[model samples]
Target chain A: MRLVISFIAGLVFSAGLVVSGMANPAKVVNFLDFSGSWDPSLAFVMIGAIAVASIGFRLVGENSKPFSAPRFDLPNRKDIDRPLISGAIFFGVGWGLSGYCPGPALVSLVLSSQAMLSLFPMMLLGMWIAKKTA
Target chain B: METLFTPWHSLFGGILIGSAAVLMLWGCGQILGVSGLLSRLLPPWSSSQDIKVRVAFVAGVIALPLLAMVSGQVSSIPPVNGNPLYLGLAGLVMGYGTVRGNGCTSGHGVCGISRLSQRSIVATLVFMATAAVTVYIARHLLGWI
Candidate 1:
């Protein structure tokens, strides 16, 4: 049951990515290109997502455990440190350069294009390096 | 003021994303953090049980786009612009950064902020500000992307 729900959730999330034009690297690049032909569409996507998620979090707070799981497995870290900032900087630069974040990059894999071929492997390598170092 | 404002699609898409997050939270007791999930799938990171669910979720992500293409709901999958070398480099950096930061846009920006987490708020701001600065440098100054 949990797996089925998660699959459905992932499916819906991908659909949302496509429908919102986020799956398009061009659209994302335009959104980030504030000095150029800026596209504010992605902002609406963020706003709409946050708003609904806020309500969802509230409802989830009332429950001790999730519907199928034993307990909620949410992040609990509260410290502000170098890894946090530096990591964000790296992510930002990458996002600005390629306009593809983790989600979109993974979703784009279905296309099996040359770009994804290069990007995805490097991404995995990056993650592996980070894990090894940490 | 409306040069490229896709208000409806963005909002509807966002709502769908939020709905998915909520479903994940309620149904599976997970946060639906993509980078985290991906990282866990690598080597000896997470348990088999956890990996099973993660695989299922990832399958869903991959399968949906293929389905959309088949049904003609989505015409073309957009490719990354600029040099492929730089694009690949960017992916490498982003992969490391997301893992180091412990979250990405969806995890911190959407799920974290929704829960009013201070860490998430700070992380989101940092990334957004950095992204803006990076864009300024890359697009405006360097003009290499």
Candidate 2:
């Protein structure tokens, strides 16, 4: 049941990504290009997502556990550390350079372009290295 | 302005994303954090149940667009014409950063802020500012992008 719900959620999320033009690298780049031809569409997407989720989080907070699971596995860490800042900086630079975050990058795997081919494998490698080092 | 501002589509899509996050939270008792899901695929980071859920989620993400294409809901996949080397490098760095930082835009920007998490708020700001600065340097100053 939990897996089914997760699958459905993932499907909906991916559809949203496509419909919102987030799967489009050009649109993402334009959104980040504040100095140049700026597109604020993605900002609305973020706002809309956050607003809706905020309500959901509040509602869910009332329950001791979710419908199908034993516990809620939300992040509890609050400290701001070097790893957090440096990691965010690295992630930001990467995002600005490619305009492909994890979700969109995975979604683009079906395209089988040279860029996706190279990017995906390297991304996996990077994750693997991080896992090993950490 | 006309070409860039897609208010309706973005808003609708965002609603869909939020609904998904809600479903994951309410039904599955999990935060809909894509990077965390992907990272769980690695050994030592996931249990059997975690792998199952992650796989299911990834399958859904991969299958939706393909289904849409078959149904003609989507005309075509977008072209990714960036320099392959740079893009690959960016992916590598992003992968590492996401693991180290413990979240991505979806995790920190969406779910984190919605929950009013202090760490997430700070992380989102740092990443957004970094992204803006990086874009300024790469696109405007260096003209590489």
Candidate 3:
């Protein structure tokens, strides 16, 4: 049942990416391209997501035991550690260069695009390195 | 299409994603963190772990879009013209960042930041900053579009 729900949800999420023009690397690249033919569509998506999530989150917090779990799995650590900073830098640099964030990249995988095939392996390698170093 | 984005459309889409995340959590006690789900692939995996939840979480991620398609929220897939090499490089960097940061954009940027998490704020900042720099270097320094 959970798997079924997740599968359906993934389809929705990926479809959203496609509809919102996020799945398109060109569109994403255009958004990143501030100087030339800049596209601000992604900003709208961000704004939209923030607005909805913000309100919904408040509602969810009102009740204790958000789930069967005893408590929320909130991050306990709160330090300006090296891994933290370095990770941010890496993420930003990568986003700027490719405009393909994790969400969109994963969704793009289903398409079997030549780019997705090549990019997927590199992403795996990066993850492997991060685990080792961090 | 109009040059500027429609505010309501953005709002609706955001609401959908955010609400979906909340619903999943409330209903199933799951956090929509992609990295968390992927981490399950690690060794010594225990069956005690909520395999159903993990599978559902991933399934939800993939299914949401197809639902949108059936409802006509999504029209069709668009064209991808970016260089494969650059995309691959970016993917590598992101995967590494996911581990180093301990979360992905959705996890840190959305869930963590929403809780007024200092780490998440820094993570989000780093995400934005690096992304900006990467674009600058790629477009200006490398001249590779």
Per DockQ, the best of the predicted structures is 2
Off by over 4 Å in 3: A1-12, A67-71, B1-7, B42-49, B64-83
Q: Order of candidates by DockQ, top first? A: 2, 1, 3
What is model 1's DockQ versus the real complex? 0.69
Model 2 agreement with the true structure over A30-116: per-residue lDDT tens digits:
888887888889998898899899998899889999998888887888899888888888889888777788888877876434568
- Tens digits of lDDT, candidate 1, B4-36: 578899999999989989999998888978888
Where is the poorest 10-residue window by lDDT in model 1 chain B? B74-83
Q: How many angstroms is residue B86 displaced in model 2 relative to the true structure, after the best TM-score fit?
A: 1.4
Q: Local distance difference test, per candidate?
A: 0.83, 0.83, 0.65
Ranked by TM-score, the better of candidates 1 and 2 is 1
Query: Could you give me the TM-score of model 2 versus the true structure?
Result: 0.94
The TM-score measured for candidate 3 stands at 0.83
Docking class of 1: medium
lDDT of 3 by residue, A1-134 (tens): 44555555455545456556666666666666666656777776666656666677677777686545545544578887888888878877776666666777666655434667777778767877776655
Model 3 interface RMSD, one decimal: 3.2
Model 2 pairs whose backbones collide = none
Clashes of each: 0, 0, 34
Q: Which lDDT tens digits does candidate 3 get at residues B19-89? A: 55675555455666666566554433667667666666666555555455557655444323356776777
Kindly report the root-mean-square deviation of model 3 from the true structure over all alpha carbons: 3.4
State which candidate has the highest TM-score. Answer: 1
Q: Which ten residues in a row have the lowest lDDT in candidate 3 chain A?
A: A1-10
